[model samples]
Target: MKKIFVLDTNVLLHDPQAIFAFEDNEVIIPAVVLEEIDSKKRLADELGRNARQISRLLDGLRDLGHLHEGIELEGGGVLKVELNHRSFLRVQEMFGEMSNDNRILAVALNYHLEEIEKEAAKQVVLVSKDVLVRVKADVFGLKAQDYLSDRTVEPSDLYSGYINIHVHPSIIDEFYTYRFLSIKSVPGASKLYPNEFVILKDEMGTSKSALLKVSSDGARLEPLFLSNEAVWGITARNAQQRMALELLLNDDIPLVTLSGKAGTGKTLLALAAGLSKVEDEHKYKKLLIARPVVPMGKDIGYLPGEKEEKLRPWMQPIYDNLEFLFDTKKSGDIDKILMGLGSIQVEALTYIRGRSIPGQFIIIDEAQNLSKHEVKTIVSRVGEGSKIILMGDPQQIDHPYLDTVSNGLTYIVERFKNESLSGHMMLEKGERSKLAQLAADLL
Candidate 1:
């Protein structure tokens, strides 16, 4: 049965191309949604960019037919800019204020009433990204749903980048002796991706095991190149961290992604490998670190001082790790040390747009806050001889429109799992401290 989907303003703002995602269902854009989108088109951030894109898309659709009445979409549904269904009588008593969300709800309510009056089979559904908006929709006795077309994978089904395979005990001994094992030798390992880590366990129920990574060719599993040696005075404290370091230090794998909880050392490990590659190995000319400026709690509005001063609070986590790595004694020593190094650059993710970064080791911290489009823009900016590492905890997203499965970090991890030049590892253990680990697991 053909359905009628009333889209909220945030749905379009979250994804400009969400109009075509309903697949032959009639998509209705309430007049209030357009007004909200127009209000955001003048900003300078990703939201503004998306607002503009959606506006232009709607304008282009106008040429085909009258949008106010209805236009046949390419997906076999009708697209309409609803202007006459702004009645708030249905929700005026329940929601007194004629706010934008209520206005959108009013439009959906009107359609639902019309459908009932005519005994129509078409289902009227309100699609939104806001939780409260959906709740309000339910209060009006309307069917509401979240816009979920952008999610690359379900949270439970997200790729972990590592798997354990139970094999004959001799197979582990063989891997130790030859330092190489073919994927065919392991049962139920036919679907492994390139560069995915594997733990070969004893099939006899023993604790013996061997850690190996799938070769880039996806043909065999090989031993890790890096031994127990420390990278910039930081060594892996757990098996997953070791896997992350292997991917981080390998120059052949140009793109690496790490996802873990707060104190799992995602940022610390990336910074350590970046420093080692830039300062010791000389493989890259500079180390560039960046993170989104999304705040955790109520924003402090703005800060006083220069550009570095404004970024200090957002980049403090990076600075903390850098200071520890450099063994700085005083508070201002990190700034002086950074000035002396001349090879490390820490900046906000905003400045990274439209710039081609080459011959540098780039690390994007807290990448879970970024949208899929934002991640694509950042990754596409990588130039020749550059390596980029995106690390974050998907479960801790701060973006209003992003969730655990829809953020860019999870998207990249799942999308690039099959690529030869990409490697991913989800760190499981937190090495920060026992207290931190306890809080992460229990609280």
Candidate 2:
């Protein structure tokens, strides 16, 4: 049935194109949502960018007809700017508030009553990214739903990039002797992706095993190229880290993604590989690192310093990993080493847009806080001979509209799994410390 979807301000901010997502359903943009968008249009952040995009989209739609009445969208639906002035009267007696949330709720309530009076067989559903808004809509006896059109995959079904198979003892021996195996030799291996890691074990519950990776053609399995190599004084401590290292150090794969919980060494491994490629191997001219600046708690407001000082708090984690890789003992020693090398660059993700990056080993840490559009922008900026690594913990997403499934890191993993130029690995073990791993698991 065709339903009327009342959009909250956050839904539009999260995705300006969300109005066209609901197929053949009428989209109602509350007047308060437009006001909120206007208020945020002046900010110099991703939110402001989205607000401006929404304004441009609405302006483009104005050529069709009056938005106050309705505009016929390209899809088989209508877009209307709902201008109800009911002032939250229906919800005031229950939960009194004149906030935008309540005002949006009033718009939905007024629409519901009009539909009921007209005896229309249609549903009025409030669509929002805010859980509290949905709950309050329920309290007012209205149907509500989360805007989920952007999620690429569910968290449970996220790709792990590797699989284990029980094979005959003879096959393991052949892989060990020849150091290569054909995909036809393994059962149910047709679905494997390029650069995917595989663990072949003896079927008799013995300890004989072989670790291999799918070749670029996806037709054969080869031994891991960097399994025994130490990157920037950090050796792979587990099987998953070894797989990640293989992908990270391989020059053929232009893009690599690593995901794990805190203390799993995702950032550490990426930094190690980047340092080796840029400084040790001279494969890339510079090592560039950046991350999204999503605040965990109440923001510390603005810092009173220059660019480097302003970015110190956000980029300190990256500096710590760099310090470990460079083995700097004293304070400011890492800064001295970086100055001497003249081949390292660190910046915030905000300033990376509109710049084409090339000939650098770029690492984007904490990528789970980026939206799909932001990820596309970053990946599209990579130039020839440049390697871009996206590492993040999907479970530790700080983006309000993004979750494990919808974040940019998981989106890249799912979208580029079949491409030969990209590879992914999920780091399962934490090597930082036992206490940190315990906190990650138990607490």
Candidate 3:
């Protein structure tokens, strides 16, 4: 049956193209949603950019017909700006507020009543990215759903970058003796992707194993190219970390993604690899590090200082890792070290837009807070001879509109799993400290 989807303002902000996502379904935009979007059109962030894009889209639709009267969409569905259904008495009495959310609810409720009166087969559903909005919709006895069109994969089904295969004991021995194994030798290897790490375990149920990575051609599994030598005094303490290091240090692979729980050394490992590539190997001219400025709790707004000073708080995690790599002992020693090196740059993600970064080792930390469009924009800016690493914990997203399945980090992992130039690893063990690991696992 054809459905009627009432869009929340956040849905549009999260994805300006969300209106076209509901296939052949009638899409309704509450007048209040347009008002909210208009209010955000003048801001300087990603929200403002999305608001403007959606506004332009709506304007383009105006050429076809009046929006309030309903316009035919390319997908054979009607798109309408619901102006007459703004009656708020129903929600106002129940919620005791004249807010925009309640107004949107009122529009949906009026639609529901109209559908019922006409005995229509169309189902009225409210789609939103806000949890509270969905809960309030349930309170009104309306069907509410999350905006899930942008999710690349379900959270449970996400790719883990590596898999264990129980092979015969001789297969492990062959891999050790020859240091290479054909994918045909492993069962169910037809689905293996380029650069995917494989752990060949003993089929006899022993602890004997060999770690190998699929070659870029997806034909053979080869030993890790990284030697036993540590990068910048940091060594992988776990197998997952070692897999991440192999991807990070391999210049042939230009893009790498690392994800893990808090204190799993995602940032630290990336920094170490970047520093080695930039300073020791001279493979890159500079090491550029950036992260989104999303705050964890209540934001301490309007921080004072220049651009670098304002970015200090957001980039402190990067600085701490850099300090550890440099073994800085005193306060402000990192500044001195960075100044002397002249090859490392730490900046906010906001300033990276529209700039072409070349011959640099770029690390985008906390990438889970970014949207798909944002990640695409950043990655597309990479110039010749540049390598970019995106690291974050998808489970710990700070973006209100993004979840583990929809965040940019996980999106890239799944989308580029088959690409030869891209590699990804999900670090499972927490190596920061015993307390941190315990808290991550238990608390």
**Cα lDDT listed for each candidate:** 0.91, 0.89, 0.90
Looking at model 3, residue 233 earns an lDDT score of 96
lDDT of 3 by residue, 259-311 (tens): 98999999999999998888889999999998887722223357887767877
In terms of TM-score, which candidate is strongest?
A: 1
Question: What lDDT, from 0 to 1, does candidate 1 have?
Answer: 0.91
lDDT tens per residue, model 1, 269-373: 999999999999999999999988882222234788888888899999999999999999999999999999999999888778889998999999999998888
Compute the lDDT for candidate 3: 0.90
RMSD of 1: 1.9
lDDT, candidate 2, residue 312? 90
Model 2: how far residue 309 lies from native, Å:
1.9
In candidate 1 the C-alpha lDDT for residue 172 amounts to: 93
TM-score, structure 2 vs. true: 0.94
Ranking by TM-score: 1, 3, 2
What are the per-residue Cα lDDT tens digits for candidate 2 across 1-443? 79999999999998999999988899999999999999999877778889999999999999999999998887889999988745577778777878888889889988887787775557899998899999998986889999889888877889999999899999989888898999998886778999999999889999999899999999999998865767789999999999999999999999999999999999999988888898889999999999877832223247778878888989999999888888888999999998898999988887788999889999999998988888998999999999999999999988888878888899999999999999999998889999998999999
Once fitted onto the true fold, the runs of candidate 1 whose alpha carbons sit more than 4 angstroms away are 295-301
Top model by lDDT, which number? 1
Clashes of each: 0, 0, 0
